[model samples]
Target: MPVDPDKARALAFPPVTVTVERGRLRMFAQVIGETDPVYVDPAAARAAGHPDLPVPPTFFFSLEMESPDPWSYLADLGVDLRRVLHGEQEFSYHAMVYAGDTVELRPRIIDVYTRKGGALEFLVKRTDIRRDDRLVAEATAVIVVRDPEVAS
Candidate 1:
């Protein structure tokens, strides 16, 4: 079975909740090769005028990973995991996210499209990150589903 655009449009992902821990922030900073002290040290972040360690660019994707079994949900929808490819990812920030902030990630599917006569289909999912009713960021992800029949 192929992806049903209408069903995909109605798909909703369970929210993931996480508290921004300083240790996790530092670890993420180090792994990403971030040299800015603000990313690792709370004092440095404070000195830089931030209340706490600010999230590094692209870290939110990891946070979104907190989304419980994102792929399982797709598989449940009849999407074949083996044929899926990570197409693209993007983020838009409305406010700063800092350490110690408890945030919730509410994700939902936005659009589904196809190409090459349905041989290549794309699933677009968007997750809204919020803190106390305030939107912190919006992350968009594109997953490409390839038709096994079209493989070279």
Candidate 2:
């Protein structure tokens, strides 16, 4: 069945949260090819004025992976996941992310629009990395989901 464009536009997804740990930070640094000592060694991070291991600027993307399955949210909008393609991704960071911080992710459907050939869904996800209500960092991500037919 063809998806209802209006319904898809109104879909809302639940929020996801993750606790940042030292091991995860080290793993993320390795995955991103970060050779900085601050990312891997606690002593180095402390020497650099950080309380613990520091994550790279792009490390916030890893936090999004812990969020609710984005595909499931699209399914609720009547969009088929098999036809979805990642069009673009952009991130705005307000501060650095470090280990031992608990981050809360609140995702919202920013916009849903269609062109002549396919649909585009824009989502703005806000992640608040906090330590006991103290704001550590704010990361805003914009994700664009494009329909396959639009490319052809």
Candidate 3:
């Protein structure tokens, strides 16, 4: 099946809500080999002017996955998971996110296009992160899907 930019633009995904947790942040820091004290220790975070453990770089991507079905959007677009690759991702922050904060992620398919003579399709998704209805960050990701019949 071919990708349809119009269909992707018309779809609406439900917002996802997650409460940042200290333990999870610490674990993530460890898994990513982050040694920054503020991301793991509340005391250090407080000393650094944060109310609690601050989220590390790229942590919002993990939080966004907390949704019931993180990959459902791909299925809705008739994308074959096996043929897809994570093309790119980026995040911009307007404010810091700390553990204990409840954040909402609203994602939308902002753009879709084809490359390599239709052999490859790129889907761009932008997710806005809000804390108490205030914008805190934005995450953009590109998913590339390869045409099954196209020669690699």
Candidate 4:
């Protein structure tokens, strides 16, 4: 394995607080072709019984990307970016979120495993997002690392 499972499991990213912004959300809606007006217009969102433009799905991913020191998690695991592949991502929503709300994300290592005689390493992280102590979403990301020595 490129990374020791024990060592990787000890890695944890600092909690990050982000305030959802309308402009960014609108741009995201535009880019992803989310024709839903609720994603782009606050008025439409209010009409739909939302405080503000409901955060379009998957917006948390982008917010987390902007997290302080986005590479800190990898650094703690001593993983090389060149050998890492973003294998998968998933999100579980617990409650609705709106633009302008401040959310905090706490990310931790959830699983670490190896395959193919340790030539392939799989690392999974689960990030919990909360709004004022209420769980809003939990995002999972899977990273696959290829051992450089195995390639030779």
* Candidate models: Cα lDDT each: 0.86, 0.65, 0.92, 0.86
- Tens digits of lDDT, candidate 2, 32-126: 78898988999999999998997677666677677657458766765566656665455665566678877766555555555545555554445
TM-score of 4: 0.92
lDDT string for model 4 (58-92, tens) is 88888788786887777667778888999999999
Q: Estimate each model's TM-score.
A: 0.91, 0.74, 0.95, 0.92
Please write out the lDDT profile of model 3 over residues 4-103, one tens digit for every residue.
8999998899999999999999999898888889888899999999999988769999999999999998899898899899999999999999999999
lDDT of 1 by residue, 1-152 (tens): 67988888887677899888889889888887889988988898999999999987687888877655757767867988888899999999999999888999888888899888888889998989999989989999999999877643
The ten-residue window of minimal lDDT in model 4 covers 1-10
lDDT of residue 7 for candidate 3:
96
Worst-scoring 10-residue span by lDDT in model 3 = 143-152
**Model 1 segments beyond 4 Å from truth?**
none
Q: Which wins on lDDT, candidate 1 or candidate 3?
A: 3
